[model samples]
Target: MILALAIPAILIKEPWGPLVLALGMLLVASFLVWTLLRRQSRGFPQPYEASGLLEVVLATSREWLWTIGPDGRFTFSGPISRELIGYDPSELLGQHYSRVMECEDLAEAIRNRAKREKPDSSWSGLVTACRHRDGRRILVEVSGRPILDGQGQVRGFEGTTRALDVPSAHDVASEETRAGVEAMLISRTLLTAFQPIRALNNGNVIGAEALTRFLSADDRGISPEAWFVGAASVGLGVELEMLALEAALSAAASLPEDLYVAVNLSPKACLDDRVPALLQGSSIPLERIVLELTEHHEVTDYGPLGKALAQLRREGLRIAIDDAGAGFSSMRHIVELRPDLIKLDRKVITGINADAGLRALGAAMVAFAADIGASLVAEGIETEAELDAVRQLSMNAGQGYLLGRPTVAREEWKLWSVPVHLKRPASGPTTGQHKRP
Candidate 1:
């Protein structure tokens, strides 16, 4: 049975393939041992007896095996817990899972739990942080499945966790990066750049998207994306995102009031209470702000996200689903959120002027956006031909090098206050006008 399971897992190309295989073997070993003990006693094994069998199976394993009761408190913790997270098996009993996790990761787990509609569903390969008894943070991968009773009801959850190996050099560098991100947050040093979004038809600047840029004396040429990723690894992702949002909104005070400002935010960041608070406290009216849902992370559940956006929408904020046509998640966001604006990903617009398939997709998106009462914005319109193609497709707005590039200079932002018509000849006059959003 173990070989049968191992054969299938060996074919899995995922990064967690080994972890899956190891967990499967451990679970099978536990069952076999439990059966032998039951046979010897001529009765069903008691809870403690089953737990003893689990410990025997886990003794030789490197991974930490754990079981949680219906109340989500640890009911059984394998001996490996001591080596894995610096906790004795007895010490973790009756303690909530959050007791060993970072606060942000704990909140995320809670949010995910709230989103689970089916109690019997399983989850695997979740990379998250765990707290060591020495107060150090350790990165671990967790996989678990529901523990069901005889009546087929969920009784608890059983899982295995193993720390991800990090090279000593990489670990040192990560610590440096974490410190840099921390210093950045403390000093509020993130710089905000603005990229103009123009009316595709008339070539008038209608809005600007806020982008984050980083510069520091000890900069290692790391990109802004890398900085955010590093911040997330250390459990500071939300704080960094919120800091960027605050900086962008603060800079928006200098831009033309009529032009809305779009800020990119992952769904996780949007759920943070500080998000609404920051927006509400901004000098710019909520109506002039567009929250662009970025594709940085996949939204596991749309229920809470929809509710959060709805409340913000009610407060006069408009939602825009970014990277439309890029993947299924973006399309799902469009359908579920019913966003006010749908931004066409650059992939669909890059060669759209020459590709029939791309043009057809652009047209379909335009019609789809209209049917859903949303405006379409073509992203990454780099050439006159691409701009003309999107214009022909009747995309409501566009942003790219052909229209405008992201800039941090206040002088350039001031230039946008007075819309400058593009020198390129119009592909006939277009009638599309910029709405409030």
Candidate 2:
């Protein structure tokens, strides 16, 4: 309209044609430029916001991440991988896994990885040692899944690793307890409580596992120290072993025919000369019992424990590495004892399912249990998810809150189903015995 008006004006000698044309061109050009700039100048995502594009990368960069190609060659790694394992990109990109693993543990891990390499179980766990730059060992718990290519060939793996330290309940008890436990070799104050161990496969009560519970006769509200510490103080750990043995055997006679009770054994019991003799006439069959080795903070005296375990094995008593995850790194025990069972730590099982990483590790331990011809039992199955995780890991035995709570001894003990006591008053004691009123 302006151009037409200007043209008319110009024809009428208004001299407005050129000015209007130039102004109109300028306006059109400016609009086009503004539109182009608006399209091209959109703001980028900020890294600080969670949903921002940079945040995704930043998050992954902080986690231990890696990618593997076919033939089990490394292909990619998150920036944090180096921080986690102290490996350079060149060291990992094409290296085979065995080079980094502890020599003894590597073979079995390789076998497990190989089995998982072609299966649906792309994610499996492997507990191995990684050598630090200083030649020190960094025990790493690893879980990995095979990274298949577009063609789905036997590619490498991606996994995560963290250093591990699993402490036992005993570890946290107190310095006083440790000093006292090591101080004694006999005790008349020893007592025991039994907790029923149920079989997950059959839903039948398999047997009760005995735990040491000590009572304070003077009534200090059942001092925890008196039992373990008293046993150590009296130097009657061996005698206490016999007390538990008799109780376990007596309890066994009335239980289900197939039931086999497990009793906790102190390191002292392994060295006790009479342990083998005491079981000779017991009602419970030697082979039916599992002596769970406890009181093992370290393996400084492994020679004695090893001999005792071997002797027990020879006597037909099954061996179980109690608190396998908590006590010292039990590879030596596992290899040397070749225990019939590996009772996993609750710490390791805690939050296993929610954390995919823990699930992988539990799976790996389960596999190790399988390879050794031992059954796997996950301790502290406090949640359905934890149970489900164990189930997914193909665990056969699990004991924790989800199964049942610990109980104490009484008539109709089956109903009582008490946790094993370390020391209780002798049943026929004259007076003022270990039992507190």
Candidate 3:
């Protein structure tokens, strides 16, 4: 009845796991509902202990052990219970287990467990609410096992309970990072920088990708990756992405009207209703904005996203899949979403001049984009040889340090014409090279 699991890290980092857990929880609920309707044989009350299966789930130090006697009163509550519920094991003795549980349907859970067949009596993944000493509701995941005597008679119940809201070490670090993001958002300390996307045909800057950067009060620049990842960890991913888009559009207002501006957003944000609303209010025309979907998280549902994007397309906004050819989901993203453009990942473009396999992959991308009527943009082109290799493949557009580093000051956009400084020629002539293949 209204169990919510808000594992921010899991939601952002491992979306599939939560989806599986949600399915499992639903199945468990269905079984319980069936058992209640059938009123299956109610076994005698029994004692419970930590069985091997439960030991594995409770192996983590964060888990707390709990046991209930035949009378449905907690006989043994672990030490962590004190920190969690403000009640020590001694204090909780002889207290009804339901006293701490906030869920009204827990009685149903207990009733369903009573009808379990002997020697096979165990129920897990019962998500419910628990009350803290301060009366705040805390979500808890519980599993219970029925303890039996040598005669196969029920004795009591033993099980493990863990708080779903507990934060891991990684989560703690993420919280600190989120604090930084909050400060940046509140103080408006963030800025949008433009990285030129050049037309390989004439080497003139065709457009630019909007990149977000945070100015650290300590004078150390924060990486854009950290800012975005931290924002996702704190449930502000869509907000932060939208903020960057708005900033980029505002800054790009000074840019030449002929050039389009590209902005990166996660797939989750693309499905948000606010996306179209944000676009409509921006000074940039829909035709001049390219919304590049980042591959930071895998998209499980494409149907609704496709429809939302279809609406955007009708409004003249273009879609581009960012970091293509970097992972298994690239092809799936291309086929399902059918983006207006595809941006080759930096890894694929880095050493294409000498790597035969990369060269072949680049050619395939060019051919595929042409077949699909979509433009292909090569990213992170930091060498003359890399540029030359892409030009030979008849690539559409490119962006990297070779073209120009991202700059917040619009006047510095002219740096696109300067030759990129290279440590060494990329296995080819630096200046004079062969014409396009």
Candidate 4:
């Protein structure tokens, strides 16, 4: 579900063999997953032995495998199950897959899934339960490939599952979790909150970034990761994303003409035609709405991404690369795509004041953006010192705690509208307090 935005690394210009294509997809997807798991551990075990029963079904057969049951139980498992659960395939059986899961989470998810709702999950990866060998329940990553029975009617589900190895839902009963989860389950119930992105020098509210808040009955807040993961689990990720997009566009319609609204695009939804079409109808100028490529996803195909962006650019829509330094392709990608805005990630800003190498890198990035005729926006500008350093970097703009905090239902969005250098106009040009959102 977290990977709902993940795009396959390879693109298909023209198809030759369906079987070959499927195999290719499997290998690429499996490798990506394996990397995520193994890179964190010394050496993870494979799902099942090549000669094991699960091996025959998962390896020889194309049907995806899962060691889970409908009640979110991993009472049984297959070889591939080990790949997902981080346990021996034989260890899991009769374990309440939801045992390790937060109770409230299981209930809510089950309720949603059983509703058989059509979610915006066009790009959501499937999830399943796989029993761990040690009789422990683990959440497994899986791909749902229907296991057809002799009758050809739907009987049971079969998919690959991977354990995130995450501990119990962080405070599932907490009000925040409840609110976030409920909003995601019922997309429209959530309000798309907007916070202004101001220019440090002039205090002008140049843009607004939409943030989500749930109007849940319980009033608990949900994390973006949890919301996305739950939505992906029930196959609603794309729909949720689109719903957010709609809300964002609607919210932006009330802002100034020059104020661009930046909306996040899930990896899977990147190439979706609906995105361009929706923007085309927006009341604001298309060029003013920045479609940020979130670091949460990887752009598997630079060619397609480039081509897609080129078409958008042709339509006068500008682009911005979010979390600039967080990916293997961040800086390289900025050059490749040549976006209008390059957002410097917070990682580089964390200790730049104390680290010369980091400061130089940050300075270089600002210079690179200038050289490419793109504006550089530094994120995480929390400290007065950071603001001074960033200002010295001479980047086009910056945003962080040092400037202001993100406010959604502010009494007056204009309160923090001052441009950089004028943020604390009454305070003798001293900077304002900056805090992380």
**lDDT of the candidates, in the order given:** 0.76, 0.56, 0.69, 0.57
lDDT of 4 by residue, 228-294 (tens): 5555544556777787788778776666566778888765666777887788887877778888876
lDDT of 2 by residue, 1-437 (tens): 46644554555544666677666667767877998877665553333354565447736654456665543345776666566566776766654342344222343344444543564544445545554433234445566666667997645566765553422345553444344444322343444555556555544556667654433233222222223333444344465566666665665665555667787776666677767776667788887788776654445657777776676578788887765554354455676678888887654665566666667777788889889899877765655555666666777777764565544544444552333321221233121101000
User: How close to the true structure is residue 188 of candidate 4, measured as C-alpha lDDT?
Assistant: 74
lDDT of 3 by residue, 83-102 (tens): 67777778777655545652
Error of 4 at 226 (Å): 2.2
Global fold similarity of model 3 (TM-score): 0.56
In order of listing, the candidates' clash counts read: 0, 33, 9, 41
lDDT score for candidate 3 against the true structure = 0.69
* Ranking of candidates on TM-score, top first: 1, 3, 4, 2
Q: For this target, which candidate reaches the highest lDDT against the unseen true structure?
A: 1
lDDT of 1 by residue, 200-241 (tens): 767889999998866554433334654565677677888899
TM-score, one value per model: 0.59, 0.50, 0.56, 0.55
Q: In candidate 2, residue 125 scores what lDDT?
A: 50
TM-score of 1: 0.59
Strongest candidate by TM-score? 1
